[model samples]
Target: MRIRAKQLAFAATAAVALLAVSLPASADVSGRAVKIGVMYPLTGKGATWGKHAQIGIRLAVEEVNAAGGIGGVPIKLVEYDYQAKESEGITIINKLATRDNVLAVLGPCFSSVCEVIFPLLERLQTPVISYCSAKPGLSKLSDWAFRNSLTSDKQLAPVVSRWAKDYSIKKVVIIHDLEDAVSKAEGSKVLPMLFKREGIEVLDILTFRTEDTDYSAQITKIKSLNPDGVGLGSCYQNAAGIIKEARRQGLSQPFVGGACTGAPALIELGGKATEGTYVSTAAWMDDPADAIQAFVGKIKARNGNKAFPYSAPRGYDSLLITANCMNDNGITNEKGDLASDREKIKKCWANVKNYPGVSGSTTMNEVGDGAGGNRVLKVVDGKYVDISG
Candidate 1:
């Protein structure tokens, strides 16, 4: 049942009970709906994440419109494909802020892109909430900048500590991507510190690039150390490859992943190798709570009965929080001005507290900018199950 993200995203055109928001379908007030731009890598190597994000955003749009259309003003999504390139992000944000004049922006899902766009926030005053960026200092770069997903430290620290205490893990090894900010911060700094606090010995640390296809050297080191646990800070594909290689190299110690690696693709790619591995993330797709299940059901029905992607929850939550901020601040189409009301929405997002969603509750923090709930997930028989305490 291996499924590509684009397939998971667009297989079923089965219309949701609610309507999908697109570009200015009927115009809200005066020949234009309140525009919110969505930027993602819809056509490149990382298009999978973009597609997953699109489905989640579309579901949120449907939910928002069903609930009387974001303060009686129907929202329109201005979607763009930056193909996961940071340079493209600069161009897209410039266009989204200056030309499209969208009130707020969502996505540009990579932290690499976030770093490039952080400077644009002060120049444009447009609030941006990233669904996948987990680097710690991103939100602090600007008052208008925010994040919907939990940073690596927030998502992984407690869960890893709990797992170590419960499993009596005394020694660990970390394999990380040196070229990535999120990966470096989590693997080289946060996870090690958390392990140290738990009295776990870090035997060694290893590095790889995002583009490396062969992990034989790293796998050999992991096999040699054979610590009580193996920690990973990597993209889904890289994590899967590493897990497969580690298993092939006879490294049987349990593996734990940071926030970004918690996705269906991990198991889909690693198969039996990923079984029994655990990862921590902001959203728990296997949650049984009514709100979580209902949201999952909608996505399944719309995606031809396939399992939901991890990114969907954050994308859906991002929209809900953004709309709630608008409602809380009373920033509406009453003034019939998108640019003027953008500042008010930004202010509201800065002050948002206890904003709940199917993914996790989020709050605008002063230091890290934004953070949310977290869960530790273990892979059993090729499926991710909530195992956090």
Candidate 2:
């Protein structure tokens, strides 16, 4: 989730116009719908998790609306699909800030997309709550940018340390996607750094691009080296392909994946081959806890009993959190001033104490990133069994 951005100054004027519309003199609690825009890659390569996030956002807004909304104002969710494209995300952000003019935005879940849009939000003055994007330094891009999901550091530390210690693993091979921000951070930076800290040897590092389906060449290379373990920093499908190919090529060492592979699709795509794979992730939808079970039941029921991606619950929690923050920080639908209301929302998010959400109790640090821990789940017979100590 650590996407770098190209310069995007051309759209600055539109952000100014959007901000201008919401600058009024006073706050009034009008019984109006508190409109918030929801953006995600509803249709694309990673659309499975993106759609899951969309469903989670929809479920949350529907539930809140049925409960008579926040402080009597209906919480309306406006949906948009960026198709996992940064350009598309920028366009949608502009629309949400100007034409739709929503009070807040719930995200494009990829940090690459966020990197492109976050800078624009500092002036647009609309807060964006990304449920799954976990770029470590992204929150500093704007005061309005917030994440409810775990960062790569928080999400991968436990997985690396546990596997390294428990397995007494020395040399490891890392296969990750170079083009994706999330994979690059985990595969290239975070995991290697952790390995060095633990005095583990990084046998070899390999790279692939997003949308690359075949990993036979990389697997063949891995089979030759015969490392004790392998780590994947790619998204679920890519990770699945790597794991499947590695197993087929007779490399039986256990596999570990960064949080990007935590979605249900990994299990589905890799089947029996995924059984021993360890993943460090945030969402625990299958946790036996009653609260998680209830939330999972609600979403599964809505989506025809199909399992929603792990991202779904995090997205759900982010929206509810922002809404609750707005209400708690004196953000009235009556605040005719968009500027003042945005400031209050930003401050509330920055100073958020312990927000008990499905992702864990999140507290924002001074840098605006959430404070949370990772759960290491090893796939056992198609289920993610927690093995964290």
Candidate 3:
């Protein structure tokens, strides 16, 4: 009887251990909501990009949740508005990392803000993916940082070549925003280098502050140079203003700009002046791909049938990619798994190859920037037409 009792106790212990081993696998799938951080400039100069990004991210989260979310655990986005200020951005990132305890962050959408915040990712042990911060080589600042948008240099090269060839541009005058990091890099560095490579002489380089509404002085200088074309290293608002000012001053030379100037707002603001302007962009909204058309339809439905910037699609793609990493890596989203889950997601993002996003086929290059082909778009009659083909 004693021996039989000993055997019964041993069998009960074995059964309990087996149940414990199996419970965790099921528990992980049924864990608490997964948390993701969304940081964007909702109110200041970068509001347009941020607002559109919010739409995209919201749509993505909705779809993911409706489809049962990450392993049946709903995703909760911890959102914050950085207001396009560098100081605000720093504070928000710190809060997200230390207090909110989100798994990954989506954006803080200005290149300048990104420049300051990316270096902190490694220390925080968090991964950041920017939707549209296109300063060249900013991702190289931290292994934890990645960009879904193309760098200014990568985006400008092909478009510059196309613009130079089509317009027979021999000499160019560059105008850039002095206060904006991406604009400064695009105007003072990327554009000049691209123009030289295309054998187009850079006659002069002019500058303007981000807040400067009047560009008469710069336009006056550009008119004096009489270059075959004008190169712009400015965002949509400033670029539109400069183009309009140039037209007002009777300078009709064609204008070409990098990624920052490619938003639909430029065409809306510049009106007739924006016609014939060439710009580089990561996504072409008019693409006839079935997936792209569906995305546009959804966006239009949500946005009162208005056209959206490249940032929208890029934002949508960022969320999907983050979700994919979580799903594929068996991320538990449990409090105990937060650190490991963050590292796993970071490693997964680092190896993303040919992710067929709504924007394009995105692959993370060695420097942590997305490598997808860019489009050289020409403004015609009030809309961007893909002329890269």
Better of 1 and 3 by lDDT: 3
Compare candidates 2 and 3 on TM-score and give the better one: 3
Instruction: List the candidate 3 regions with Cα displacement exceeding 4 Å.
Output: 1-31
C-alpha lDDT values of all predictions? 0.74, 0.76, 0.84
Q: Write model 3 residue lDDT over 1-389, tens digit each, in one string.
A: 11111111112112223222322332355456788999987887757788899998888888777656776677899999998889998999999999998999999778999999998987999999999999998999999999999999999998999999999999999999998889999999999999999998999999999889999999999999899999999989999999999999998899998777888888888899999999988988788877788888988898889887888989988887787677666777777888999998888788887776788888888978889998999998889888998
Q: How large an RMSD does model 2 have?
A: 8.5
* Top candidate when judged by TM-score against the true structure: 3
Tens-digit lDDT track of model 2 for 218-269: 9998888888898888888888888999888888898888867887789989
lDDT of 1 by residue, 1-389 (tens): 22111111211122222223221222334433667889987875445677878888888887667655554576789999988778899999999989988878998788888998987889897888888788877888888888877788877887787678656799999999876678878889988988888899999999998789899998887777878988898877889999999889877788888766777778878999998787877777667777777788877777676665557777877776665555444454543566557877777666666555666666677743556667778888778877775
The reply for model 1, stretches above 4 Å from the true place, is 1-30, 43-47, 327-336
Off by over 4 Å in 2: 1-28
Model 1: how far residue 208 lies from native, Å: 0.9
TM-score of 3: 0.92
TM-score-wise, the better of 1 and 2 is: 2
